[model samples]
Target: MKALLVKDNLPDFNGHAALYQMTPAHEGHEFVVASAANVPFSGPETYLFPADADGEIKSFAELDGSYRGGLSHAEALSNAGYTIG
Candidate 1:
């Protein structure tokens, strides 16, 4: 699954973004951001689809632990013609 992980550093007040490809492993999944430059900035960076994207934004609490937030990013990418796991 391909995802865009957005990070923000609050202390530095800088925001970084990156595209990642996630793969399911034996223990868990692996998250690899494509670019080092497009990384997050703050300690608690929120990951969600941009408003313009044709995807839904579900709250963390609403997920109920059934689905991982990273899956949403994969879904968005799949919808946009990217392959996902």
Candidate 2:
């Protein structure tokens, strides 16, 4: 099991925005990133990197889990210096 930590201000599937942080999951956590040209998160999940040249989501693995996929998105989030509320 894993956890997804999405930021505040990013809306959910139903176009509602009610952001909150976790109390720390027993399992490791991943981040939910939002960049330009993107819509608010709209699903039971989320993603990080943008699409690729072929318009497929390839850059995603570059910013996934803490070790396996690459640099940890959780660490990346911490590196940004924002306190998790």
Q: Would you list the C-alpha lDDT of every candidate in the order shown?
A: 0.29, 0.32
For residues 8-58, write the lDDT of model 1, one tens digit per residue: 221221233233333322013233221112224523322422221222221
Tens-digit per-residue lDDT, 1-85, candidate 2: 3323344344332222222232342222223342222234532322334332222333444333212222333443343333344
Worst-scoring 10-residue span by lDDT in model 2: 13-22
Candidate 1 accuracy as TM-score: 0.21
Clashing pairs in 1: 7-40, 7-41, 8-41, 8-42, 9-41, 9-42, 10-42, 16-39, 17-38
Q: Which sections of candidate 1 miss by over 4 Å?
A: 1-18, 21-71
Clashing pairs in 2: none
lDDT score for candidate 2 against the true structure:
0.32
Residue 29 error, candidate 2, Å? 21
